[model samples]
Structure formats: structure tokens, C-alpha cells
Target: MNQQQSLFDVEETIRNSKSQKASEILTPSTRKILQLLTSQRINKVVTASLLDLAGASHEIVQYIVGPIVTQQNGWQQSIPSWVGKAIAVDRLDTALKEIDKGEVGKLASSSEVVALMMPIAFEVPLSSEWTDVYLWASYDALLRHRPFENFKYDKLWEKIGTTPIQYEKIRSDYETLAADIRSRIVKHAAKEGWGKRSSNKNKHPVKATTTESNIQMEQLSLFS
Candidate 1:
């Protein structure tokens, strides 16, 4: 085939794959994870890593075409705008830490001060630029910075590099969205008979506390 013909064929294949419902092929949790991972615009974008995190085995990976994501080399060039915002947030976080330590001299650089101030001056597109998948990733990223339950408002504000009002609004929105996602994942897991699996080693009754812990562990595994 000619180069143009090949390109057209690839596009057509991708479109066909996307037309099919993702639920028909993969579970809700798997589809969500795959979308979140693929939407990440970062260096060393590994297709296999995305698949692995989504719990797709090699055999299942073969059947995943463009529905979950387009397996292409363009992600590196199309870095998400939010990722740049995140870098600025990180810088501000360091500056704030220095300030708290009474190390005012650490932030003496005018350019550094300006760079740090930029995030506060400009509004972050916390709920605007981000899609649901991106929101999921953002929530996970914040969890890495600090667990949500243990997060202090000022700490989160500095970590996000946003004004108090803006931080409050966005933080609430993120929590709401994250809760919804978790609910859906739990429902999907129950739908897939995850709760009803029997232990072959257990001919005896499983303790109630142990079962509850196992359930919690399974939910954690889906995210981990």
C-alpha cells in the first residue's frame, strides 16, 4: 500500500475499535485505569506499563486496539498542559518549605520568586482543562504527595500552589469526583463476582473480620 493508504487504514481501524463499547471487552475498572494511564502525557510513555497497570495480560493486550488508547509515539510531544502546572506547583512547594524553616535567603532569587508567584497570580484549570480520567490521575498524584485523609488545607494549598478559595473549591470537586469513581469501581467489582469468590483452602467458614479485610484488600488492589 502507498504511505497515504497505510495512514488511512490505521485511522479507520482506530475508529472501528473505538465504536465498540469498552465494557464489552474490559471491566469498568480496567477501562478507567487504561484511559487514565494513556491520557498521561509524560516522558518514557510505556504502552506495556499502561496495560500492566490496567491488569491486562499479554493475551488481552493483543485485543486492545484504539478503544482504550491509540498505541502511538505522539504522547511525548503532546504533553498535558496540567503537567507544566504541576511543575510550578512543585517549585512553590519547595519555596514554601524554605520559608517555613526561616530560610528567607533560600528564596532570594527574583526570578524564582516571580516563578513561584505565577501560580498564585494565575488560576489553575483544576476542573476545566482536566477530564474525568485526568482528574483520577490528579487525585492519585496528590495521594502520592500525601494521603487525602491526612492532608492539611495549607499543605494541600501549597502543594497545589493555589489561593485558599480556589484550593477549597477544587479540592472539594476532586474529592467528590474521586468518591464517585470509587463507588463505580466497587459496583463493577461486585458485578464481576469478585465478592463471591470462594477459597479452595477454606472448607470451613471464613471469619467475618477476615472477609471484610479481604474485601478491603481487593478494593485496594484495584487501585494499587
Candidate 2:
């Protein structure tokens, strides 16, 4: 049937696209935890918590893991829920406010300050619309480690607060990442389509190659 073939086509396209992102897999330890999830050696939910905790620094891990492994209560229960909240985050200013409040507070308070998250050094020189797009896309790049949906060239650099010396030192990489990001974003959009979802009132689909997705990613970039 036509629907069956369409599904196969999408599967093939996604498989190929996933291959292109071979560099984006989780770290070895994280991967091992994922394996445990699949193997059922540990509870799937617990494994997710462990993997999420893997993102923390070694000292933090040491402090937390001991209690998690030893405690009889639901110490690990809150972790996966927390990670779920993190990956679903949707605003940058929320992150700023969260950090400003301190990570020792609530679930939203003790948030990860994503690396490569640069301070707003200079005013973004683009138009208001484009400026918003560029910032969101740039943050999405760091959040997802997927370059697609990001700004290109100088727009990319400016959003990340790339210092002058660092920019010059790695200018070539910046250009390369920008190109790849744009291409990926376009390809992702084309593959996902430009339709809107019925469940939401927004004009954009939850995940599409159009401005709606950009808006969503932009919002998420700020939060995550």
C-alpha cells in the first residue's frame, strides 16, 4: 500500500540521517547504562536516572551514586523525572533565572549550566525576528549537540558569545559547524514536513523544518 511504502521511505531516510550523526552518541559510560536499560539488568527507569546522573561531574556523581545505591528509599526516583524535565525544557531565561536562584534549591533550581553556554557579551546585531531565531538556534545547538536549527557564519559566533581570540582561533570550525547545522536543519525539516499539529494551538508542528519548529527550539534552548 502507499502508506506502507511511505513509512518505509521515512524509515530509510531517518536511518541514513542517523548515520550522518555518528559523532553524536552518548559517552561510553552513558552508552553502557543505556545497554543496561535494554538488557534489563537494571530497571529501565533507574537506568535512565543513572545515565542522567552521568552528566554531572565525577565528584557530584560520587556523592550521589553512593547514596542512590545504598539508600532503601526512592532516592533514585526523582532523578529520571528530573532528567525528563531537563530534556523537555523550553526557555533560556528560565535557565538564567534558575541559575541565578542557585541549583541547591528545587528541581528547577539545581539545573545544569550547559557548557558552551556563553554570556550575552554584545548586542546581537540582527533584526528582532532574526535575532531571536539565531539565539534560539544557537542554544539548541549546544542543548542537543545537533547543529541543525542554528544560525550560520557570524550570526552563530555572535550568539555563542565567541570571544575574539577564540573566534579567530577556531573560525574555520565555526564556519564548518554553521554550514552543517543549516544543512541538517533543512534536511530535518524536509523530512519531517512543514505541517502543524492538531493538539496544539501553535501554527507549527511539534517537530518540523519550518519557523514553528525554530520557535519551539528557540524556546527550548532558553530553558534547557
Clash count for each candidate, listed in order shown: 0, 8
Give the per-residue lDDT digits (tens) of candidate 2, residues 37-62: 32222222232223222222222112
- As for candidate 1, its clashing pairs are none
lDDT of 1 by residue, 1-224 (tens): 43234323333333355444322323344333333333332111122222222233222222111111111232322333334333323323332343235332111121222222223224333335233323334443454344246567446545655433333434554454444433443354344333221421132221211111110011121122
Candidate with the greatest TM-score versus the true structure: 1
**TM-score, per-candidate, Cα-based:** 0.23, 0.20
Q: How many backbone clashes does candidate 2 have?
A: 8
Per-candidate Cα lDDT values, in order, are: 0.31, 0.29
Candidate 1 segments exceeding 4 Å error:
1-161, 164-168, 197-224
Mind sharing the TM-score for model 2?
Answer: 0.20
